[model samples]
Target: MTRTGSGHPRHSRPGDGQDSRRRRPPPKGRSPRRRRRPPVARTATANGLPSGPRGHWFLVAAGLLVVAAALTLDGYATGVVGETRPGPPAGFASAESAEVRRGGPVVNVTGDRPTSVRLPGRTVALTFNDGPDPEWTPQVLDVLARHGAKATFFVVGSKVARHPDLARRIVAEGHELGNHTYSHADLTAVPGWRLRLESSLTQRALAGATGLHTTLARPPHSPAPPAVTDLQWAAMKELAAEGHLVVLTDLDAEDWSRPGTAEIVASSLPAGGEGAVVTMRDSGGDRRQTVEALDLVLERLKGEDYRAVTVTEAIGMPSAHRRAGAVDRFFGAALNLAQRASETFTGVLRWALFIAGALTLGRFGFFIVLAGVHAHRTRGGTRRRNAVGGWPSPPPVTVIVPAYNEAAGIQATLRSLVATSYRGELEILVVDDGSTDGTANLAAAPGFPGVRVIRRPNGGKPAALNTGIAQASHELLIMVDGDTVFERATIGRLVRRFADPAIGAVSGNTKVGNRRGAIGRWQHIEYVIGFNLDRRAFELLDCMATVPGAVGAFRRSALVALGGVSGDTLAEDTDLTMALCRAGWRVVYEENAVAWTEAPASLGELWRQRYRWCYGTLQAMWKHRRAVVERNPFGRRCLGYLTLFHVLLPLLAPVVDLMAIYAIAVDDPLPVVAAWAGFVLVQGLIGWYALLLDGERASALWILPLQQFVYRQLMYLVVIQSLATALLGVRLRWHGIRREGTFNEFTQAAGRSLPAGGPRRP
Candidate 1:
């Protein structure tokens, strides 16, 4: 081996041997080299651990829990059914005496002895149930006010909370208010604790809405006292123990069944003008009939010289409403505020779902149309080139592999490069960035005679690549990662693109080599469906964003003019490609030039790798944000697409997911499920088409549905964390993936059969 003036080893050729007897001193300005420290063995736990504090995940979980609780409360409050269903007629208990069973509708059991009372002759009490409706309650109140009649409204607490103004208007208009339970749940069907809870929440709602609590309670679906069942009596007794005066009805108009207005009005008139309490509804359904019946009933009663009064007035009892305490008012107000906030949040999520769906579908269509056009153009170009006998004479090329502790795969990488079918003079440069695993020794072994190994301190991949570019003897260079393997024609296919002087870089198609596991299959699907398909589309638009490092060819002049591979961004490939595009050089994609790279096998490793990729891409996009306003294709096409589809759409995806859950909770799930199914079907079609274009089997797509449940969420979370990190101005270190040397076996086998100088050019 010979040394240049800079003390760096020159490119070694076949049969170049060092003199065993010569002992050379250290270079002029530098001391003898210190032994490199063995690289630390990173454990699986280390790979899985997050680089930042885990507190963010805790906060996210807590926030999700709070939202879930709020949605649950809202759903429970508004989704109750059967609130006005008629009770069974034959379930009355026989324990009650004839006097108690046949007495008045207002029953007081709060004292040692139970008491029942009826209205006096010619005095009627009108009571409305399931009320405070925004629509019909006001109409009912208007009719009563017109006739100077005072009635009672048994208000559902949820309805009152939602329409507090209506509750207040009832009191202002000289009517009485009574509790109908928080969610209009049936007292006989609920447990003792739930009954208590129902009463408590209703009181709080009343306090929040009207600043008062009612002692008059009406169990939902309660019938006249004569028909009270054993279970109903037990629940009424519990309410009495809680100091409530149970109010039952004397006459049920049954307007909830939408019976004719004539029947409703006839039912409201007491038998022979006897005093009675009549039940009607202002809510739970269309109540126009009830409103009209009330007007007619009032006119008829007035014709007979009968007067209408409130329940408490007709029963000779004091007011049922009292001012609420301060604590109840505060908590009730908080509940109202929380419910409103949850409703607002749900609305936002619905809008987000619509926007995300539009963007996603639009992107899918864009990829399909443009990618098809690109494929047609590429095939036509290939046909024309074949007619012209391809490149008359290929140019000399240098292949640079930057390695760091890559002894596990360096030999395989070198062997794969040596076996290339490229006709031109080919040089392989392995720049070992201070690896303690004998990476340089593996590259310079006896099996690979002409491969050159350059040793340098561990200054990172960008520095190592810069050193390789500086030392290369050819004007065309191809960069490859130490863990990637190439097809025999990969270099030839890549170099052929340089026939056009305007082409600055060519990105080869990258495939996953070890895609047997679930994680690997998911990545394989992404590479084909996401990265490569988008690349095809981008190439046609002339604004390709990234030329992957695993296999990419570049004109050395173009690279040198831009100051080779800057370390300013972790995604150096994307940064460089963007710069080239902005500099007016065309960066294209070559689908036929394929390279196989190993993908992460474990979820932890995959998370780390993708987190770095996403965060770095964000950094690069920010660093080159000025391009958006520039008059170049990179700005007009590339940046716009990346921002809309990649950043904005992904950020909105979680809302779409939340909306699905909300629909199932408070709305119909069939529509949401149908939409999801349609989305999946469209995605499957796209994946199938992509596999056909890439010459892969469609069997791998069976995992696509499962990906939605786990892989998709993981990616969304990555985007969120990346955005957070970017917003916080946090600096992230480069994450290194541990390689398993997946291609070693095949490359070793090929190496044994090939000649010492590698295979002959085809």
Candidate 2:
């Protein structure tokens, strides 16, 4: 063997060997020499993410924990079902018995405790319970003022805290306030100590609102004097010990029942000139009837010579107690803060759920419409076809295969490329990007002819591709990943797409070559469904986002015009394609141009790969965000599509997932499951159609549903991690994947059928 002018080995006769060796070397300054860089030693984590991704994981966990805590607090406060903690009392605890003693308005309960409510004859004390409502409370106050009457309002502490202004207004307008217990929970249903806290909390709320405290209290759920039960008597004794006057209604208006105004007047008038207390609500529901009844009852009471007065005033007691201490003020402030926080968080969650539902439905509708159009166009061939694979004399092409430490798969990839059936002048540039492995040596080995190996420093993938682009000897360039294997007609089919001069780049259909495991099959389904279908739609819209690196065809001038592969993003292919589109060039998808590439076989590998891809895509998007406002077609269509589908949709996807969980646990799980299943079904149908169009089996879609459970979550997490890291301004280094050369293993492990030429490795 003798070395030719191009440094390739050539066969020579024994007599011609000396002459071949003596052939003139390349002219001075014209010879291409391999570029070398010193190897730098670096440490790597277990997951292959440079600088470690653990910090980003921590940030994401912290964020999720915050959201979870907020939701948990909101649930706890609302007496929501399914929560582990005990909820508020179902209703006011059973009523108790109390009697007026020694001709005094004070009531002596059966529990050997003194509770007082002075019931003066004829001068009926008309009191309303459950008040401080924003809307109805104001109307009740106005009626009281119009009649020149004042009544005590038994205000629920929670409502007073929520509407402190109304509570203040009630006092400013001369109507007195009474405690109805914080949250309106039944004291009898809770322990004695809890009952004390409930009363104290209400006193604190009153103090915070009106700068005054009231000892007058009304036990919830007791309509009249005789209705108070034993348990309620015990609770009443407890409140009495705390200096609270338990005011029980004598005449029950039952206005909370929304009974007619006439009945309310009749009930309040009372039969035999006995002073009484009436019960009504100002909040917690529509209170139109309560307000109306109060107006008519007040009018009838005036005609009967009965004047409504505050409970304390009618009972002949102090209207309000002395100013509260520091502890009471602190409790009031804290309760108000918690209530405000709970309300805010609840409102946010409600809106989040609504937005999530809308986005889920919108995504469904958008994809269905776009996919339907894509399928119809595919069936009808509305776009002009660029005939591929039958040219008598195809144009010359150069295939650039960028390799790092891809020694394990490079040989088979090279073999697959050499076997392409295109009858064109084809050259292969194997740019080994500073690999420690024997990739460059193997590519330049005598077994591989016309394969030139160019060595460069480990400047990353984009740099390596640029190196290859600079050294290529042909006008048409096809980029192939070192781990990818192409079909015999793939190159021919790809180059044919460029028959239209406006076509700057063409993306090929890249299928997972190593579909031996569950993970691989899931990716295979995704490639078939998520990616290919979108590409078909994008191609028709002339808004193609990416020309995948696995197997893509490009014109040399177009690539150079965009400054070759961009290093600003890890997704250089996407960046370059978008740049080309923005530069007034067309990017198209060619489904017939098929390449089989090894996908990540493990969850960890898949996460790292997808994280880099998503993060880099985000970087590219931000770098070109200005395109959104541009007037060009690429700006209007491509930028708009990417902004909606890529950026906006991914950001909104997590909300859908969260809503699904919340709905399943807190709302209705079956409908969420049904909706998810419906989405999967539609996606599966789209996948089936895509496979049929690509001449692949639709059976691959069988794993799609399973993907939602495992693979889809992993992808969502990847997107989340990337977004978290990017938002935090954390710079991530390129992480190399630990490839097992699954291409060879897949062929043997599954006993799968090979392409026409059979397995190239073994």
Candidate 3:
């Protein structure tokens, strides 16, 4: 501490530690002031999120599982009604059972196990061994009376032989009695026939004394003396396979040492799971002490929420009719509960599916509406009427085309551009992104003039665009795909939208260049219905997510303000569009400005493109998540819409779809259908709306269902690869391989389609 003049300690300045003793001089060409770094931001806020109707797929999944479990339980109940259920106490040696079926075929095949099948409730088995002695049995009975606990006694038949009164009391007290054998000898050491004789004698004795037959048997411990062995397990299994479960101890109590009641209770497990078994050791114990401890253990475990039952009832293997009516009631209640669960799941799942389907279909509707608007606006002198309404004129345009291996379509795209009747001005900048083919020379060698070519190492499309933009001599930058060709008035339509000062970007229409094959045709319909309608609705909201890289124009100033085109992400166009809009820039769509691209000719090719697109979209969203919540200067806008469309839907839909598939595979499809039907219906509405909005003739409506059945469903498979790569952080780069020969291949797969032009049949 340093002292002030008043002798009071004061805090030192930040630089006061060690270097305070030295006098340092500033270096040459440096300012005298200490420089400060900008403050680091802790958290970014998302803003400009638009409201949207979206799906909650996770809830749908949990609901389905619940329903499935319920159905399984229900079906089991129905199966139990008339089927012959096995008795827990039946044995081959029992006199009455000697002529009856002692065990089923399965019991003989796989030895019975006393560990009963588990059910998902707090259920427990109460077993008492070496019992039926008069003194202990009566005392145990009184304690059970006090607390309402019932237990199954694995009786030493010899004890019952002496005290038939105690045996009768056990049965009268609503307890189950199973044979521990007459002599209490280890069945493991005895032959099967001898063991059978012992089991028979015990049963005969119990039946004579108590007038009840037992179904369950527990061996001495987790293992038995080699003779009695799993004969008990075998019996339990025999019972369980025939609709019964052999009760086994999941716990141990070691209470036979004459320990205090507190000690016995201390060893007890809290009642849950498949229930716990607390036992009296066979070797040593003051019978009275063991008996007394049983009372407290029962009380405490009951307090811990255990529902005690005799072995038969606990395992659903009751014989001698112990608590049969009550067991039936409990089983009935359980079935009812399962039915209710099934119904509830069906309700929730149906709604969730509806939402998903509806949202998707809605997007399609929006596309159609916008396309219709475009067609109507461009037709019947409407363009001339809106022409002079103070909308900015189409400025001189610079078109930057980045080519990697485009020897095929360079001439076609160039010819289309030269053929344009843009009233004002135009410029084409074809930056070759390090082409291995003759794409650049093809543009230069011919009468193709003014397509500025800047050759750069393989940096990607965004960097090439940036390079071209830097050398451009115009205020409007239109980046057309190297493989796409536009119509004569495409530029005019796109440029005219710039007249609205609020519009920062304008997206054009895109159609499949080739739609001959089944896959391509399906994609064609999907594009028309899903994309066109959606773009218009999005534009109206100023929440347009992606100004597709294929055909879009940007205000040069706005592009510059955003620090030029970025190559940091795969979906650079989407990233830039959202970034600009969130920053208060208005983005619109020009439906008349149509361009075409070669849709994948095969399912494999389509899958690859879609996979990459899905993955790229995710990367861009994550990279710019700051915009998810941060209120841009524009106000709260597309943020919510973007999350719903770009983040949440893709994140959740596949899970629901896949789980539904699994449910159908194992159980009934009713629940699965219930969960997803709402989604499908909503999808249909969207399809219809899209076609309606696009001004598409109802004649083309047939494609709507075809798209839904074929194209829309592809999202499941595509999302799988996207999700895997995102999770595993795999980088994917797809440089489409150019076919070996044919200029027809150029128009078909490499170049853009002219508006309403005959499709190139790839």
Candidate 4:
């Protein structure tokens, strides 16, 4: 079973690497008609949850919708379904004295129902509805104060809660207080508990603001007493039971309709020398007419020998104001806080939606720009690295494969390395980072004869790589993850780029190996479209952000100059690469060198893995923040680029995702879908181009839209969680993904054609 130095058997064909562009046929005996496995379809919960928090967004939206519906129901019930009290026009009412003298059953509260009070002299009570409004309440109050008149304001509880100072001013100005019910809800239409809350909460707010509780109340939209329906009467009686004085007006001044002042004044005079309770609105829409007509009405009333007074005073009944006790004050404070909290939540949600949309759009625009720039840079083909002279005749290289619970893929990774086609001295060093599995034994097994295994305590990947660097016999080092399987020419291609003396590091192209499932396909698209193209751009600028752990080559002297891999951040590769650039070493990309690595099998695993990567990248960026102030090209472009694209863009990406959720939940879905489709279309074009550049297939683009719905959100969450954790000073331990040796497909396919492979290293 002796195999070639390329790790493939002697009979192996060309294009045997895990290059998706090259499709290999079945071996001599095997059937060429093998059925491809279908993508795995994972089931969702009863609610059809794809991912955990994504489903929770729907729940949140549903809850908000419920709250909004309740508020709408209350508003509609008050405005349309409930009662509207009809008042007599001026010069028409003559029952003022008769009704007062014809009162039935002992009434509890004065002004509870319109009082037909026959005062000692000709007197009229002026009452305003729906007020404490900032614009008009003051004008009405000023007019009343100027004319030496006092009015009763039945204020909406919500309005009072918002403008408590206005409520206080009303009491301070010698005006009477009355409840218009919270949010002006119709008590006759709502349930019993809601009715109670509507009444009581207003009382609490008024008491809290003015230290006086008003027993005077007017059911919203209720008509004059004689005209109230039996149902409205029943509701009024219920309020009476609660000790609320239901104020009904005798004269109707429909100034709320913006009628002329003369008409409003005409509507206010009492008929047949009877004292009437006059009604006008101070708030609830444009009230300029109300404010304007007040002085004219006052003058007319004075001329008619009618002294305008508070409802209680005109009715000769005691004031409804009760000084609030400590308990009442406390209740008022709690009620105010509750209302403010609701308002605050609504405000915050609106701001969040705006911010999310802005960030989402910004990020999309930035990605487009970056992709365009990347395409222009690598338009014809990959530009060569700045290494002094390309390493045409390569030097000896030591490959370090760091493993942590990677027993599943370590052998394949090592075999892939041993089979490299580089004609230089090469050795394999497997650093098992305290894997409880048989990673060490497997590496030292008889099958992998020349492979060297070094065991150490569970120090992280950075520590293990550092150990490998210290122990390596060669000056040229290649670092590979235990789960990554390299192609035969991957090492040679990567090493050749280091020929430029200034080129300190080269990042290799990474491909997703297990593209058998939907998740894998999504990641496959991302690797080809996102990461590889990003490297091409980074390489053009001589500021490669990360020399991926999957496959990268570096000069040992450059590594030592930067003190090897630093454990200060979780993303050692990125940290090291940035450090190299900051230290005046150029880090470039090598697209020809390809390595196949397993993508996470499930969402949970994908989240955990990406969480670590995103978090580490942020930490690394922060550690190198000082680079932003440097004057070099590395600082100007590399640090500036990282700060803008990597740091700022990621932060904004989550907001965009949130805006997407908001749009889907609240706005029209068509525009949202259209915008998203447009973004995806652009993304697909870039991905397809990148795949073509990297010599891979575009078939994986089919899952690009699905990725937007599922994978894109998961990635955004990862970025958000990572940023939050980093900002909050929370440290996350390394989380390893469950690997199932995805490279076995490539190995199985290769083995079918090739003869036995004797492990060969240059």
Which stretches of model 3 miss by more than 4 angstroms?
Answer: 1-394, 633-639, 651-685, 695-713, 737-762
Q: Write the per-residue lDDT of candidate 3 for residues 351-468, one digit (tens) a residue.
A: 7667866786675565556556655655653446454334455467888776667666677777677767676667888887667777778888656656667776655666667888
Candidate 4 Cα errors over 4 Å, as ranges: 1-122, 251-274, 341-349, 383-398, 418-428, 433-459, 471-476, 487-502, 518-545, 586-593, 614-622, 625-735, 751-762
Say which prediction, candidate 2 or candidate 3, comes out ahead on lDDT: 2
The alpha-carbon deviation from the true structure for residue 671 of candidate 3, after best TM-score superposition, in angstroms, is 8.4
Ranking by TM-score: 1, 2, 4, 3
Pitting candidate 3 against candidate 4, the one with the higher lDDT is 4
- For each candidate, give its TM-score against the true structure: 0.85, 0.82, 0.55, 0.72
**lDDT for each of the candidates?**
0.79, 0.70, 0.58, 0.70
Query: On a 0 to 1 TM-score scale, where does candidate 4 land against the true structure?
Result: 0.72
Candidate 1 residue 622 Cα shift, in angstroms, is: 2.0
lDDT of 4 by residue, 546-596 (tens): 888888888999889888888776677778888988898888777767777
Model 4 alpha-carbon miss at residue 649, Å: 9.8
Clash count list over all predictions: 0, 4, 58, 22
Error of 4 at 78 (Å): 14
TM accuracy, model 3: 0.55
- In candidate 2, which residue ranges exceed 4 Å CA deviation? 1-62, 72-118, 186-208, 234-243, 326-331, 379-392, 445-450, 636-710, 745-762
User: Between candidates 1 and 2, which one is better according to TM-score?
Assistant: 1
Per-candidate RMSD vs. true structure?
7.9, 9.2, 18.8, 13.3
Candidate 1 is scored at a TM of 0.85
